[model samples]
Every structure is written in C-alpha cells, then in structure tokens.
Target: MKTIKILLSFALTATLFTSCYTEVVVDDFAYVDEPTISLNQLLRSHELWYVDINSTLGYGETPFLQKAFTVSFINGVVYANNNIAGLGANGDGFGIDVGEYNAYENILDVYHDIDGFSTFDVYEIDYNTIELYNPNNDTSYFLDGYQRNNFDYDFVFYDNIHYFLQEYEAWEKTYTSEYGAINEFDNENYLQFLAGGNDSTFRSSQDDTGINANNLYWDYTGVYGVGDVYGDAYLKTLTLDYDYLGNEYFELSVINDGKIELFHPSSETVYEFEGRGYIQYLKSESGTKKEKVQSDKLRKQRKDKVANPRENTRKV
Candidate 1:
C-alpha cells in the first residue's frame, strides 16, 4: 500500500512539472493589437535638427574677419562653405557667384554685400581655385582662364549645391524624429498601450493593417524621399503584451529613408552627423590634411633647430 501511494505522488509531481514547462507556440496567424500611432506621427514627434557651429570667424578684430560654415545631415547630404570678406568697405573682400559657367566664367565682375557693405566687381572662379586663396591677408591671386572645353565649372557648382541641400535634408529628418518621440509620450492611448505591454515591439511600415508581427514578416517596400514625413504614407508597428502586473515592455522598428531598423525601446542610436561618405573616404581626406599640417609644422621646427641647434636642443 505504501508503494502504491509513493507511485501516485511521483505521477502527480511529474504532471505538474510537465504543465509548467510547456511552451506556448504563438501562431503566425495570431491577431495582435494594431499600433494606434502612425510611423509619420512617431517620426514627426521625434524630429530634430542637430545644429553645431563648427568654426565661426567674425568680421574684424573684435568680431572676426573670415567664417567657415558646415551643415551635416543624418539622411541627407552635407553642405559647407567659407565666407570670405574684409573688415571694412575699403578693405579687399571675396565674393561668390554661381551661374552658368559659360556666361559667368569671363564675368568676374560679380556683386554682393559683405557684412552689410555693398560691393561690386567680385570674382568668380572654380571652387578648387578658390581653395588655394589665402583668406587672412590681401593677396593678388588669379585663376588661369581655362578653355571652355577643358573646364566644367557648372558641374562643380552643381555638385557643391547638391552637397549643401543634402545636409539640410538630414537636419530636417533629425528634427522630425525628435518631435515624433515627444508626441508619442503625449498621446494618452499610445502611452497606455506602451504601459500595458510586457514585451512590446515597434516598427515602421506602409501597410494599413497596423499589425506589428505582420510588418516583420512582410517584405519592406517603402521608399523615402527628401523631406518626407514619417506619416505621409509610411507606418510604424509596435508589438506588445502585458505581464501579470501590466508593466509595459515594447520593441520598435521603423523604415527610415530606405532601410528597416529594429530598435530597443530604451536604447536609441544616434549616428554622428557625418556627411554622405564612408569612413574610409572621410579618413582619407582628414589624414591628408593632418599629414600636410604636420609636415609644415615639422619643416618649421627643423628650420628653427638648424638655425639655433643649441637653443632648440635645450627647449626640447
């Protein structure tokens, strides 16, 4: 009789363990609550423009004389320009003129306002040539007029303009993202939905069904253009389920520009605002500049040492 009782107890324990260890396989076709917030709404809510004044030079001794400007983007191209001008009206200054190369090439007599001073007869040259000019002091610099067949100033100008526009677009996209996040928090239904989930996921989509899991399974086909808002046609998916206490846990995914991104609710990745080039390309440009600067500094230092070897040795 004791053996029979022990066997029955063991059977009951095994049954309990089996029940607890069973895994629930959610059907691929199972229905999940659709996201109330649209992808456009999310992007618009979190939209932001991260502006940084890289280097600012003023107009004169007190304010500054020359200024360089650069605008970086996350989704768009980067634009950069150097403002060349003098301190006073009588002082020499540089002017920029962008037009059809044929018409504007010989017409170096461009006009513009430099620090509130209206000046005429500004010179127009290829950006490459302009890069060689010194902005600090008055120096006579000239661009060798190239044959029409040999030079493509129009192409260069177009490229520069395109780069600047790209940077502007990036700023706009960032601003939209920041605004969207703020709006998401303010929406009562969205917040409640978020709070109720134990494991919630969010993703951007274009499908109208508003289901999160479907978005994951579906092939992403949304193509974002410049200045496109998140909600215009694109959609966002949020997947979530609540624990016993109803604390929310969620996952987010969005179709940004052209790519689909899966992001954690708590962790957001902000790429450094680098313009439209790979790290290798940027590194190459930066490396070249660094090398040039170092070479120049070394040359100066070597000259000093040669001039006064004893004095230089003591300082070193």
Candidate 2:
C-alpha cells in the first residue's frame, strides 16, 4: 500500500511539471493570438518604400523623411533616393546608405548618420502600405512598399521633374531646331532654375556663357514651373513667368542625362539645353553637397526685346 501511494504521488508530480512546461512553451513561443510576423520581417519584405509626401498629415517635418523620395530597408541599413537625376541607376537602385535602423514589435528606431536618432511607430495599413508615425513630432508619413522587379522608375522621374531641374547650376542653350518661327526667345541663351525660396524661382541670361556657370550673366529673374500635360506622365509643360515679358510656355522633354529639349508651341521651334555644373545632393553618408558650383553674378533686367507681348500658346 505504501509503494502504491508513492508511485501515485510521483505520477501526479510528473503530470503537473509536464503541464506547466507545455503551457510556458505555448505562451512564449507559439502565441497565435499575437502577430506572427515580426517588425524586422515586415520592413525587410519590401525593397523600396515610396514616401508619399503629399499624403503626409502634420505641421512638423522629419528631416530625413522630408528629403527622401524613396527609402529602403535592407539588412539593418537605411537607404534613400533623394535626387531624381539618377533615380534608377544610383546605388544599384537602392540609393545611398543614409543610416541604420533597428526594429522591435511595431516600433522602428533609426540612427541617421546626419539627422541622428528618430523613432517611428510602424503601423501596417495594408499589404503594401504602411504609416510611419513619429510620436515625438506628431507627424505621420505614408509609404507605399514595392518590389524592385515591378517598380516603375520612369513614372517617379517624371513626377518629380522639378527637383531634376534644380540639380544643375545652369542650363546653357546647346541646340535649336530650324523648324520653329523666329521669336524673342532666340535672344535667350541661358536658363538657371533655383530650388529655395519658392521652388519656382528662375534666372535667365542672354549672354553666350558657354559651359561656365560663373561667367554667365543673368539678364532676367522670374518664376518658372513644370506642370503635367493632361495627366500624362511622359509629357510636361513648362512656364517661365517673366515679369515684364509675361509668361513663356513650352513643352519640356528630357533628351538625356545632361540635355533637355523645350518645344515652343507658338514659334514651333525646338530648343535643347545642356546642363552645366551639375549639383549632386547628398553625395556623402552625412548628407553633404557633392559638387555645388554656384553663380554669384549680378542679376539685371534684359533691355532687349521687352516689347513682345506674352502669348498663351497652350493651357497647362
């Protein structure tokens, strides 16, 4: 009877121990009630996250997030595509390494080489959409995840053509088609698009400055803008608002890496401009300008051909 009681007690103790161990294993390791996918896995799943700046809802801005057109997360490294000039070709399409990041649960902690540390609450909006909300700044930025194999780089390039114009110090008149009628634009030789203080700022020069941006004499300063042509991605309309000469509109086309063609609809002439003094932004890991060749020449109004009334060639 004593042996029987001892055996029964041993069996009961073993059963209790086994039950406790199994419960811990299920709770800690196989907790199905919680999300199975880790934050690291979710971030690493996409090759690129296109920062939808227009969708952003907040007054405060994130430095890194504000500058990046697209960002990528790969093996704890953060990559960003800041400029549109070399969109598909830079950093093998992943862009330059801006910083490093760590993921935990639904939070992402980034240590940018330039902007320092920033934390974001990662919320998965859908299968390919995520909202990165910065609690410190009360700002939320939406990102659309995409795989490299199916990404449309041309669309992105055309969508952000304004930034592309500002990449160069100046654009020199390189070629002009003999097809269009002669007009006052023939007197123009150089065009410079600026980035800051209202992105549409522009300066024009009639002097044959060649490829030297410093030697160029700006004759006119006004506003310039790039607009879409009836929701078309490939076609864009450019408007140069000259204060005295009115607005000059043209059909803008990027001929190549360093050349752009402008079609004047009224004169039916084609003008090709070559980029001079390229300015590559964020060339280093710490977000520094790579090659900036600024023109400090004095800006003045052009005295020649000021009588040509502004004509509405096409509606932007």
lDDT of 1 by residue, 1-316 (tens): 9999999999999998777665322332233434334322322222121111211112211011122221111122111122111101101111111111111221122111222221111132332221111232222122232222343333332222212222211111121134223422121111111101221222122223323321223222122112222553232323332333232222222332222232224434211111221111011242231111111110000011111111111111
Model 1: lDDT equals 0.23
Q: Each candidate: how many clashes? A: 43, 1
> Per-residue alpha-carbon lDDT of model 2 for 25-83, expressed as tens digits?
89977665678689999998899999987777665667778778889998998998877
Instruction: Choose the strongest candidate by TM-score.
Output: 2
Task: Give Cα-based local distance difference scores for all models.
Answer: 0.23, 0.80
For candidate 2, list the clashing residue pairs, or say none: 180-268
Compute each candidate's TM-score over C-alphas.
0.17, 0.78
CA shift of 187, model 1, Å: 20
